[model samples]
Target: MEFKRTNMCGELRSQDIGKSVVLMGWVGKKRNLGSLVFIDLRDKTGITQIVVREEDKDNYKKAREISQEYVIEVKGSVRERESKNSEIPTGDIEIVADKINILDSANTPPIYIKDDDDVSENLKLKYRYLDMRKPSVQKNLKLRSDIIRTAREYMYEHGFTEVETPFLTKPTPEGARDYVVPSRINEGKFYALPQSPQLLKQILMIGSLDRYFQVVKCFRDEDLRANRQPEFTQLDLEMSFANQDDVIEMNEGLIKELFDKYTDYDLELPIARMDYKEAMDSYGSDKPDLRYGYKIQNVSEIFKDSDFKVFSDNTLEGRSVRAINFKNLADKYSRKQLDKLTDFVKDYGLKGLSYIKYQEEIQSSIKKFLTDDILEKLKEALNLEDNDLVLIGADKDKTVLEGMGALRRKVAKDNDLYEKEYALCWVVNFPMFEYSEEEGRYVSQHHPFTMPNEEDIDLLLTEPGKVRTQAYDIVINGDEMGGGSVRINNSDLQEKVFEALNLTEEDIKNKFGFFIEALKYGTPPHAGLAYGLDRLIMLFAKTENIKDVIAFPKTQSATCPLSEAPSPIDDRALNELSIKLDKE
Candidate 1:
């Protein structure tokens, strides 16, 4: 390119007419229209039209030869387009080229450089550099940046100091498996990537950083889903002298501000709060999508007296009876289709699914076992109408909720019952500890640092099943966008919590000794939340895949196609760390 680029592809307008300007970008589209050669130049901002006329014979010939995505710089005079293209931002303006210089040429991209391009995910990921050229991809990145900026600004306004915690730290055993970094200096001592800055942030609070915030990176070597990534960013925050309500209110302001700035939809303030039990009972999901009307109803009372063995057998003790009426779905599903759904919930440990169809007359396989009064009562409890399908899950309390939860989401999605407009809610009062049969012990549902509700402390020891913690999750449209809890400030409560989780004194000392020591040094009652910024951005961008919002994201197997990570380290490098590969 002979001349320096002066204007962005999207910045030129009629007001700049006749002004000499230089523009550089990839060729969006090129065509030879009679005597004039037209080229659409595209950059991250947008696209602009450039015209090389026969009057400028040299430039016209040069422009006619360039293909899409060819890098070029053009020196021209900005002019009002003779034929306006109303579709683009710079449609009314055009550049009449006097000089054209091709900087680089390109082969055709594997994926289309448009938002609505239909290409396999593998191809898109393989050529991510080219795929990110689309205007939508650029906008997603910008939107993500804006959200992070707004969060930082909000935290600063509320007297929060941004802090950076160590990425390579000692591994804590409670959470997901960590990606370990071998240490050369300290042989046999490995540094594990921080799953979260949970401990360090608390230590920061104790160190008298009253309000601390960090837009930080966190790593978890875990199984991936559409929303999960190996390496993800989080808006990690913590505050001293702040309770659960204080943390919630501060974040609510940040959320509202982000939505108000980035979207046209107004966020409902003081978003609806549901206790964990309520969320489980009514919506069958912790992160409930409250857009539609498919609430899970407890039908135990209706079937308690019924002769149906399925319902009666499951309700012996630690079991539940739950049903979801997908209103008017009898015609939408068949026996085979229902069978597929049964298999879907089975992944979540559900034994089987029992369903009844309500048409002009009552119809069900189990109807024969029920008397007329019992059938009427069942219909009344489920609020059944003609063509309604009442899907039932009778199992242990956990499996019933899990099965119905999965079914509720599946039905809502298939029926197009979801509202695109966001619905935000806080799912609160989570169980402090959940019994982990595999581990043969109770484990902290949130984290060991979480404070139990004051009144529930007694039950934490005796009736552990009934205890609730001061934990809350910011659930947006069936996704857990973020979650946190008030920390146990008192030493006694913290000790009891650790004991309940079956962590011995030695185990606690080894794992969280520093944290326990910090709590004794006048630690203020604090609470914090970490937002999965990538997931949050994905939701706001109306994308279901987290990879779409993330630049150069890894695959479901946590492999980066672009970089091909988890590659074999050189023998010399491994030898320095005193490690050797022993493959089977």
Candidate 2:
């Protein structure tokens, strides 16, 4: 209390021996070793050992009372430790105290402050403050800040203007459900949080802002997952008078900057590009993980004339059979394991799985149905080698792709076939519209603003499903980190695209009327991308759980355990908002 801290706990080394220092931090751990009391003092930087000798009776007594996470201040002289720790940066030195002060007392933490703690995720989110004390968690938070800072610097250097858009905006009919906020002032009106700054950013381009970027918060009331959140951050950017390649090159430079600064791996210029169809056909994903070699092969030709009903039936009418040769893993899987894999793909909506195993003998689930000629043809087509295990699935075109695509990734992961490195690429030329059974109409695959490819323009009306947009997604190791597309500069083209989406006059007028108005006013050819900031941080932080990179994240149910949000509001507040609870 009497002196301000002069040094961080982690900054001290053996060179600072005998240097009197004032250190203040939380007591990470306290140990009473009979003759000496040792405390591990922690701050955001790191941790340092604090020792109070029995001879320093007053300080020793004070140190004895310090428990884990108790706030403390130590006026100590840097001294060599009797034992040196190799694991920590400040491990080689110790702080021998002249005084030990308990700045603040603490209650026991509900969760352990260690990274390897086997606590439930709900409990961890509930006590996120305590969870953040873990060195790994703190490192993630710090890395997140550093990433944003670097992004701003790179964008500024590249002549991109950072802008902020409104959080409370109109609800769009397309995309994810909006998290709506009722307006108290307006009788029954509501404001939906921005899903992305998609429309406004284009309007910025229309307003002649050459290039714009925003490190903004966007919300969607979507189902939660390990890699998704209801509220997430995006590095949104747009460029006026830019084509697909122009936007790609500019963003590629930004990505190179971030990767070059943060990661050790050298990122080669001009990330590889792939078409939507190629990615789907070869890897079963739009964002394919190219680090490993289990590329999917279409075996429909060989299976078409076979007696196997599953394959023969699927190979008809534009549907086809697909297989992935998980090389040299034939012997690794038991019959039970293969059955489990079948169940796994079923979750992706496939009826079942068929597999051909080449362990010691050539065997398959449909081996009985295979003629010698057909078997030989299948082997030749797939280029099957010794010890190759071929996973086969068949269904409708879309179902087969989704199921087999998931299977490919699952197999690769289970076998450790992929490296944990960034394999970045641009998945380009996506479909302009995809059919939505729930809506019973076509919906914009990206958004209605996306410009269809010039070559595909005529197909917009007659063969709407065949139209490809100039959209592209930056995929890293099979994760869609960010994506955007060339905008529909012409108002007529935008209307046609909406019509293809089956949006009636009322739907268009209600949802995108203002955005439609903006398109009429000299909008330029533009393309942009919004990187999922949480996913980006995950790659940098080496964390798969989206919650790890976030300071306070909600559970899978989209509830914040720490603050108990979405709880019952008082009747008075509800009445002010002109809302009433529907208690059934």
Candidate 3:
């Protein structure tokens, strides 16, 4: 603590040899070689080798006692390493210690501070501070900071003003369940965390902010997935007087800048755009992975007169019979593997998966039910070839699309069919509303604020299911990086949308009264988008687990093992909020 540090552990090089320097970091590793001690000192930048000899008896004693992760400062002279390490930048030089100060000693860590340390995720989360010392983990955090800085630079360059919205506000009607906080000041009342700054940003547009952006946190009380967390960060932005084209163009430029800065891949301007309907019809997913091709082909017409009940019955009932041609994988999937695929589709509500193996001759589970004419039509429709396998899903359109979409990704991964380093596309013209069987009513697909397409506005009342909105999503590979829509600026249009969603007048007043009132005061035509900052970092870092990019993420059950959050509070605190726990 007495000596001021002059350099980071990882910053020294052979060029700086013979210069005396002071460095501070953790003891990454240590070894005693007879009268000499060798240590690898590590900091956030990287690691550097430190040498101490018995000639400096006091410092050598201290160095020999230094253990992994021990905090220390060293006054040393830089010298060329006897054997250079080509793997690291600081590998060419070593630090010869004149003095060693053990600032703080550390107990052996529960988890190793190495990238390849195989440990349970729960244990890693519990010992996150130690896990974060790994170079790989630190790299992700540094990259995340760089990405945020780049995003802010781009936003400012585009005349966007950065603004912060409230974290605690009233709960909105649609979207995922909110994580509400009991308001002690208001007694029984509660304040819900913002899901995205969706309504608030729209309000900003109404207030003539012109352009706004925020790197903010969002929360949702929803089931967790590999790529999702209950609490996450997003780069939320909105623009006044902007239509769908204006929003899309501005965002495309931002995306180009981000990729150009963080990745070697140069993105083409005006990225390819696909309609939602077309994406679903071809790839069976709105967020289609365009890196590989195993497009879903509709064979409903080809099976119209077939004796196969699964296909014929589905077609007659206005359902679909779709197939994916996994070319040259016919021999790869055995009967057991095919049965596993059937079970996979079952998860998506499909009764079963039917497949045809085209090897030397036709081999299939339902070939006996198909006549020669029907078989020939199917072969022609799917463009069958030798060693081609065709997997079929016959069910309602939604079920078929979901099942085939999952299968397509699995097949691509199993066969190593990725054809590009990055595949980015925009999905547009999404449905305005979809019927919710659970609620027995129509609900907004994106949100109630999304503006319906001009041509489809008339169908909002009569055929809400068929109406398309000016909504769009940016999809990278197979993940939906982010999505947004043009907002309805007119108060009348907003009311009509609420009515179409079956929101009673009282319900509207309770959930969106202020938003509607703001629309009445000269709200401009606006559109906005929010990108999942975590997902973006994952893509840039080339990591599969979302937790790897996050600093302190929760487990799948939404519990933080490190801090043990969402734990019971003192009775006095709950009593002050006029709340009581309900007995199970």
Candidate 4:
């Protein structure tokens, strides 16, 4: 009998044994014995077994001809499996086939449609359509979609209107390079793809779109890393008449809901809060992963009067000394391995890294140079134990924090100290400005539009580095999941910010004159945050590679192998835009 699919392949079980059903999917596998044939029908929902008996002559013969990936519709009745395959979710039931219809025939796929297939990324990308047939990839995409849906619903419930900002806008100098689009109408001019809807969202507050949010596409022309892509999606949001605390509370509810609904883990709301200075001093990272406990310890005071010149010199320069006490990892890493770790911190501009491994006899690099009193004090200060490995970095305060911060993570990973779970930390109290020695000026750490902490306004020009901003970042497992700041609303305060950044009158007029004009017409006190949606999905799906989350991700070189984008355009089209190609 011919039949339309009444149920998905995996939806049936032993309870539906006598119920007639039709199942349709690609043939995941096929096996033929002397007189009988068995096939596994696979779909996004799951897999089910189909059996054809020799007595059904024509149907049994047709099943013999079926191969992997052949799309077929099977009319059958569910039955208990003779041999239960406990590995799969629906392994207890089998579908006894009565008839089969081949819907579509497929060539043998270049890559296997199974997880743990050892195919090259290039091959997988080239045959991405076939590759996505794998259950693992499908599951990841579904999880990502669900996460976005939950986020949207949560925002709507909390009074946010989804609004889309423009894709093309003016290029600002501070952020990463922009992906520019050529203009035929304005021949020599170009429009830039937004790095984020930074300026536009702020302008919306002036326009009274009070609470706005968008799950939007953002672009940046930058080198890619394992978890970064040139074109990415962001959960962009802005709110009027809200302070840092207000934004934080709303986001906490959304995030806690996300974790509770999506995974088996229960994420604690009102998650632990860490300040910028505390995070840097303790972890050397703004986004500290709290799953592990190897917090950095300051040893500058204990090492100040030491005979070791490196420690003493660092202190004299107004820099600092710090260490991560890898409690039991001293036995795990050998001497040669420790030297390699020393070489690693040099990349972060630290002059050197020193370590002391406490054993039956305390082992160290500068052991001979240390007096008993100094050595004892150093050990006491660090709370060192017999099996602890102490890794130290010293230089400028910033360099010490940055270098050791990274070393702590490296050691944790090497020793398997990570919890393999989520820990969200809201890092706040970020300094509003950072001094640039090259430019001989101060630059906004977040952006110029970010308001400075009210009490610090007097020091904007005189002590720019000391001024903190009302900015916050939602960090999860060591990655900044989202960040934003309470924006500058008062026109006079905005000008004062520009002045502190060493922007001349001409510089201000050229880049952000229009934004200042918008502020004059009554802007509301507003704030918002944007989450790296792709990165958030990566976290929720527990995927290390960003490409796994994106459907048609570009390679590190920013070229799309599947569609062959960024290829040479037609000569006529290039000429129409009056473009020229330069060759070396």
Best by lDDT: 3
Provide the RMSD of all predictions against the true structure, rounded to 1 decimal. Answer: 1.7, 1.4, 1.0, 1.7
Q: Please, what are the lDDT tens digits per residue for candidate 3 over residues 221-255?
A: 99999899999999999999889899899999889
Compose the digit string of candidate 2's lDDT tens values, residues 412-441.
888888865768889999998888899898
Clash number by candidate, in order:
0, 0, 0, 0
Model 3, global lDDT: 0.92
Q: Determine which window of 10 residues in candidate 2 has minimal summed lDDT.
A: 354-363
Mind giving the per-residue lDDT tens digits that candidate 1 earns over 285-370? 78888878788888887777668877877776557788888888888888899889889989989888887888977666576876
Order the numbered candidates by TM-score, best leading: 3, 2, 4, 1
For residue 332, what is the lDDT in candidate 2? 93
lDDT of each: 0.87, 0.88, 0.92, 0.88
Candidate 3: stretches off by over 4 Å: none
Clashes of 2: 0
Write down the TM-score for model 1.
0.96
Report the Cα lDDT for candidate 2.
Answer: 0.88
